[model samples]
Structures are given as C-alpha cells and as structure tokens.
Target: MLELASNLGQAPKAEDLSKSPLSIRGLTVSYGQKPAVFSVDMTVEAGKMTAIIGPNGAGKSTMLKAALGIVPPVSGQVQVFGRSLDEQRARIAYVPQRASVDWDFPTRVIDVVLMGLYRELGLMGRVRAKHRATAMDCLARVGMGDFADRQIGQLSGGQQQRVFLARSLAQGADLYLLDEPFAGVDAATEKAIISVLKSLREAGKTVVVVHHDLATVNDYFDNVFLINTRKVAEGPVAEAFTAETLQNAYGGRLATAQVDQLAKALA
Candidate 1:
C-alpha cells in the first residue's frame, strides 16, 4: 500500500481508507541495470484480499519481494500497519511459489507445518504435544491431515501447496502474502486455497496475493492492485479491476477472445 504521505505517523485525512496492512511509496527495484518495478505505490485495504495482477514479467512478484525485503529495491519505503516492516514481521505470513521450493529436501509434512511455530517455540524450546496438535489442526483445515506423516518430496504439486498453506495457517498471522499460489495447482487445490483465504478475510485478516488468473479476480478479491513495472491502478475490484484499468495494464497483449472472457468474468 503506497500512499504519498507527507508525514509517516501523522493522522490520515478522512478521505484515506481504513487501516492499511501493507503500504509502499515510490518503490523501485532493479535487477542489475534493468528495472523490475518502477516508482510503484500502494496501500492495501485492511481485512480484505488484494490481488496484484498484470502481464507476465510485469513486476508482480518482484513488487511483493521488495515489500518484504526479499529483494532490495532500488529506492523505496515499505510499511506494515503504519510501522516499519521489520517491526511487524511476526504479524505477517508469506507463501512463495511452489516452483521456487526444493521438493527433495526430505522434510516431513508435519515438520514443515511446525516451522510456522518457531516464533512461539522460541530459540531453544522443544516442540511439545500442544505444538503437534496445532500443526495437525492446521493440516486438517487444508485437508492434508492424513499426510502429516508423509515426506514432503513424495507429495504432488497441489498437495505440497496445501501443506505450505497449512503452514501459513499455523502461523496465525494477521496479514498473509502469497505469490502465484494457484499457478500450477489443480482446480480442487485452487478452490481449497481460495476458500481458506476468504475465510481469513472474513475473520478480519488482511490478505494479498500475486495472482495470475484474471478470470477469478472479480470473484475472489475485494481489491485489485494492477501494475506493469508501474502503478496501473489500485482500489476495490469493482473500481480498479474494470475493463479500462485491465486494458491499461495489459495493453494489446490480451487476445479479443480473452478480452471477452474477462468481460464476462468481471460482469
């Protein structure tokens, strides 16, 4: 969430939206001399799911990475809950793309989910029975309880995603960020993930996703952050996910048939 604030902690004007879980201002990132994201700004609507949508290589993933400091930006500032991100790390949970993971790491599903509890477990604490119970509950919520004892590398892509989602749930963070979670999953996995995310929003937790599926934007997200190496549009889905804003981000890259589908999807 990148609003041009004259003062960081000053009282916001009445016109400003409610609390922002994530905000960024003039965020610019470069890989070598090539720019990835350029002067982007955003303010995530609290308690809602915001989707970062754009064409391929449009800096969608890079923007999230920069916000979380996974990749340093060329120049920018990121804040979470009106505070520095470093000050609010425990309040946020992130799920990266499955392709970026090492599937052969030989970790068990339950162990992976338990990693979310490291903060609660502290530096030298051992996992107690209560911790295992919490981890199992999280896996059950994602429909993977039966596989808790299974090896992570043996699971299918969709199953692995569900396990990771379970891990995120076990974190019990107030804000969640996911990068292309539905990219390679089956329809069932997509449905399961969206269902859980919507539940999180209903519980008043803020969620942001680097989403690639344009067809589901209107149905799944409350807000949209459209970008293409720059801020194309940002606001509620009804306002920012419009045909005009989408066309502005995608330009002539979308086929006519695809445009028709987007029309029906947003209608």
Candidate 2:
C-alpha cells in the first residue's frame, strides 16, 4: 500500500528531457513581412506548469499559434514529445482565449466538451456513451459537472472558461496550451481555475498558460517564460520573474517608462 501511494505521488513521465517534451530552437514568426517573434528558444518540461506572460502585442499569442502550426513560422523548429508536431498532434490540446470564441453559439456545456473527442471520432462518427462518460468526468474535474446541461451562453465568464478547460481535460492529452484562462474571472473563480491547473500538474500533465496579470505570477506558476517579440527569460519563477527581466522585455514602451519612474519614486 505504501509503494502504491508513492507511485501515485510521482508525476507520470512523458518524453525524455534530453529529448524534451516541447522544444523550440531559433524560432522566428512573422506576419507577412513583419516579424512578430524573433530567434526565440525555449523548452517546456513535462509535468510542470509554465506561464507565458507579457504585455499586449508582445507576440505571446503569436508564439503559441506558431507552435501549434496554426500560423506558419518564417523559420524555426517546433517539436512535441521529442517528435515533430505533426507526429505528436494527438498528444496536444489547445484552449484559446474566451474572447476568440463565440460563446453565444447556443451549445450545451457537455456538447462543447465532447467536441474534444472529434479528432478521435473522425468525420463520419458520432459521440458514443463512452465519450459522454469522459466528458462528464472532465466537467467534474473543473467543478462544472452540475452545469453540463446548461447553455454555454447562460454561464458567466469564469464558467465559460471552465467549459473550455473541461473540453481540454476531455482531450486527455499530455500537453495543454491555454490562452488567458483567468481573464475577467472573479476572485473565487480565479482560485478555482488555479486549483484545477495545479491538479493537472499533479496528474503529470504539462500545462502552459498564457497569462496577463503580473501580480499573481510568482504565486501561481512553477515555471515562467517572459516574452516580448523575443525570448527575454525562461526558467523557474524565482529566477525569471524579476523586475529587471520585465523591464528588459517591455522596455522602449511608454508604459514601461512610466512603471520605471514609479518604481524609482517608490524606492
């Protein structure tokens, strides 16, 4: 019984780190002729929670999109589970920003979650009882099991985010890429979401969240990537989430200047 408990406490290993769960080398992304992210290199360890944070237009979202192959990168390489993304597509799950999705589509919460199984279902297939069971379990994980039958439109902002999170959970992938999971969410909801993310890490999933609130950076993340059109720093929160690093990443901007002045004044 003790051995079983010990094994349960250990995070499930994914691909080897010498191979890397997700690796980007000399990654450059451009929209048309304008470069958005340049010469970026980063690695996400398996069974860890990584937060990518930066101001608006900092190419954070662009980088994630590029990694997912949604947008073609001008030059670079992306590997998932030590294999090319195409080879490991089924092992990844993406949760886009709530603003990017149409919440008023008139779909039930359970139906949206079951959509995560579409890749496995193929075009000609319908959701089976097993799929429904998986979706229910996922909803329960996110504390939305009771709302499974509710219309997505009737839910609040945080509830909507939970629906998406449930969908990602249903995918049962090794890696999860989430974009701003806490935007506009109430304090209680934010805590709930963070708890779910921590649970994911405990369950041996690699969860990457694109975050905006800097105040909670240190409190919420195990690893952090500070990005602004380029890789500023990537490592544990204590090492990378520094004022100097943030200044460098957001420098040359008026807001950054104002912040610098405020810091100096306060000091």
Candidate 3:
C-alpha cells in the first residue's frame, strides 16, 4: 500500500526508503539545449498502482523512457530495488506507447509475446513447450488468448494494445512501467487493463503508468505523481491530487469547471 502522507517537503520514512521499488533523484533530461525533465525526484513504493499525470509535452513518457534507459538522461540517477538498472533489468518490464511499435512487422501474436522470455532464453536459444505455455497464459490474462494465432496487423487498435500488455505480462517482472496504455482503447479493454493492474498490485507488484485521464486517476490508482518538466506533487492519490496541483501541472489548460468537477469528485 502507498503511504498517504505527503513526502514532498521531508525525507522519506527511513524504513520505506530502503525498500522502495524505484527511486529517482535529480533526474534531468534534454533534447540538445532544451530540457524535457529537470531535477525530478521520486520514490515509487512497491505493491502500489501509481499514475504519472501531466499535460502534453510534460515529459511524462520521456521520464518513463529515461528510467528504462531508452532515453538518455542529461543527469541524475535511478535505482531499482537498490541496484542499477542493468543489474535489475530482468525484474523490470516496460510497455511502450502503441504508436511506437511497428504493427505491420508480419509477426504472429504468440511470437511477439514470446519475445518477453528473451531475457531467460539467450540470444541463440529456442522456444520450448513450457515457454509457449507461459506466453499463452499471459495472453489469456490480457484477454488476448483467442487472437494468439492472428497476425499483429489484423488486430484492432484496442486488441493491439491488449497484445502489448500481454507481452509485458509474459515478462513476469516485479515492476511494470506502462506508457499511455489507455490511449485510444475501448471501454472493455480499459476495464480489462485496469483489472490486470489491480491484480498486479494485489500480488505485491508495483505499477507505474503514464496516465492522461484526470477523471479516472483516483479511481484507477492508489498513488499519484504529478509532473510538468519536473516534480509538481506526489503522494497518495487522495492527498496529492488536488485542484491546485492539477492547475500547476496543466498550466491552467484544464477549464475551471473541469477542475471543479474533479475537485468535487475527490472531496
């Protein structure tokens, strides 16, 4: 469970700090001269579903990519389970944005999911029967069992998203970082994905999502980290998600009425 108290001004509780699943300090990233993320600091607790909320171009995805070593950071450090990323890569799973993938790669769904086991299977290894079963199980978890034989290009947008999620499930990592998993997905897929995330939390796994929907943040996440080029606010959802913080994060892009509606909902 996430600690409800704000950890903004003070150091994290000693006991909690030592065991945090992900810890980032003074993280800065830049594309040439322009900075995308600046001096961000955050600690994500294990077994909590956390949402990274921010406006467009706020570096929400960039921050996640940086943590995964996909995007090189200008400065700062990230620790996973008190170890470097390379040392703990096997324990982390990443699901990139759907648009980033080449869906027309002429690959079968099960083959794509099997790629998750690459860490276990060396570069020159073969897929055994047990690995196939594991991939199928992951597909079933994401409600994509039936489409396991279909070509990746034939699936609908929601279905493709589900397949990507299944691949992450196949990794069976202790920590998950998902970028825009709900974008352009159907209601049923959304529900199914949330169910999987909740299940991960219940099973003592930590999930961090780069989420866009303000209305569903509290509903889907136990913790929230608001960012806009830097850390704006972070803590338990009920306490960290506020009208003022949303304003700061979105730069007043959200209408006053919209903020009021969310504020009322939270209250």
lDDT of 2 at 76: 77
Per-model root-mean-square deviation over C-alphas? 2.5, 7.8, 5.0
What lDDT would candidate 1 get against the real structure? 0.89
For model 3, residues 114-168, the per-residue Cα lDDT tens digits are 9999999989899999999999999999899999899999999999988999989
**What tens-digit string does per-residue lDDT give for candidate 1 at 1-267?**
333332463556664422678878899999978899999989998999999999999999999999998998888877788777777789999999899989899889999999999888989999999999999999998899999989899999999999989999999999999999998999999999999999999999999999998988878998999999999999999988878888889999988778777777777
Backbone clash tally for model 3? 0
The TM-score, computed over Cα atoms with residue i paired to residue i, of candidate 2 is 0.87
**Better TM-score candidate (2, 3):** 3
Model 2, residue 254: what's the lDDT?
35
lDDT of 1 at 154: 95
Instruction: Please report how far candidate 3 places residue 26 from its true position, in Å.
Output: 0.4
Please report, in order, the local distance difference test score of every candidate based on alpha carbons: 0.89, 0.83, 0.89
